[model samples]
Target: MATTPPVIQAKITSDPVKLPLAPLLVSVVVGVVVATAGVGGMICYLLRSGKVPIRVAGVAPVVPTAPLKTHMVALEPLLVNLADPSGSAFLRAGITLSIEDPAEDKGKETNAGEAKPSSKDADAALRDTALTVLGQQTSDQLLAANGKERLKAELKSALAEHNPTVKVADLFFTEFLVQR
Candidate 1:
């Protein structure tokens, strides 16, 4: 007896399933916009609440006020004998002083008979004070590494004591010589 092939059946559809592109794209764009807005809002909130610190680049901090104006007064050079043994050492120094202008200090009150000190008198006093301080230094002391700085401090202190009216802001040694 001859047997025929078993019968097989299958179903097929001719129509393809379709997806709408416009709605899909719109949904994706909306999602992205919402996410960006949320992140931006969070950052703004943090900054406003002081929870995050921000530093700007290439910007200097603001200064509160302008600095006081000062004038420089150059004194005549001084030559003095050093306080060294054998009387063999001497010093020659040129000094300049940075003094705050009295005109800028309007807060000070002067007496009726007390005339403001003249610049000439102040200059004379400064020269005298400087000579006195310079004559006390020895060649060895002035030749050290920090000698000039020490001398400046001494001169400043002496100037303040000798003349309270003159506000010495700083001192500069234009010329210095220590001969042994």
Candidate 2:
């Protein structure tokens, strides 16, 4: 028997994929540009809509005008008997008044003949008004929960009525004592 030679088959190879360089690069560039434009548009929209705040450099921030200057006038302590039935209750209170500084009014024009009251006279008037109001408060009224606040309000009103020239911005109780 004769041996037959084995048949050899040729190998077939496929070509690699080819991409157009110009179009690929153009598409990539276009995509990047579109994304950048979209982000910039969104930022502008937010800013225009006031959703994003813009701060300017080297600009002084808005500052509110300084509050008007105030002067504190402390009054002498008062020892007054209360309107209690037994007439034995008493109140010892130290108070201070906050008023607008008189120096601020220097620019205002006043009559040449008009004279302002002296500090002593003003202080005496304040003391008299405070004593009158305090003397009317009974021990029960002064001992209540809102006693101090009520007393302050009353004092302020009384002072305003009795001394119109002196504007009391606020009243403070430095010391308070009650005896029955």
Candidate 3:
């Protein structure tokens, strides 16, 4: 028996094989197809839902309101003596208010169906109500830069209760004096 073995029969090649491009092309095609499908689905969903505009509660625009007519009414000065003996001083103050819808008396006689409200009536009511409120409020309440603001709001609320149609726009302290 020969121990050397048989001669080689296969051929030897050294050339490099080219890799297939099909895998990269398939990946690109799949990505494009998925992206298009996702976009188309989103658009179809939006259109099928009817697309009604959203409404936010308490965010509606307020319609313009009618302008109220204003009239200024002047009041007599009020004097107040402090209750405390140590800080006993008298304060004198006059108040004027810009009132809206003052009750007025037209000379023209109305038919049996008359007796509607007048500007003068509204003005008089506002003046009386304002004077009462100011009288009750102390000088500190009426005189303080910030406290005066509170007094104004209180006055408006007070007036509104008595006269619904009449509105108090502003309070003008024409004169404020103190004496010992």
Best by lDDT: 2
In order of lDDT, best first, we have 2, 1, 3
For residues 64-114, write the lDDT of model 2, one tens digit per residue.
985655567898899999999998999999999987657656566666666
Clashing pairs in 3: 102-119, 103-118, 103-119, 103-120, 103-121, 103-122, 104-118, 104-119, 104-120
lDDT of 1 by residue, 46-114 (tens): 999999999889999887985655667888889999999969899989998988767745556556565
| Total backbone clashes of candidate 2, pairs 3 or more residues apart or in separate chains | 0
lDDT string for model 3 (2-96, tens) is 69877989887998888789998999999999999999988888777857445668887989975655546676676666433546666676777
Off-target runs (Cα >4 Å) in candidate 2 are 1-65, 103-118
lDDT of each: 0.89, 0.90, 0.68
Weakest 10 consecutive residues of candidate 3 by summed lDDT:
101-110
**TM-scores for every candidate against the unseen true structure:** 0.60, 0.60, 0.43
What are the clashing pairs of model 2?
Answer: none
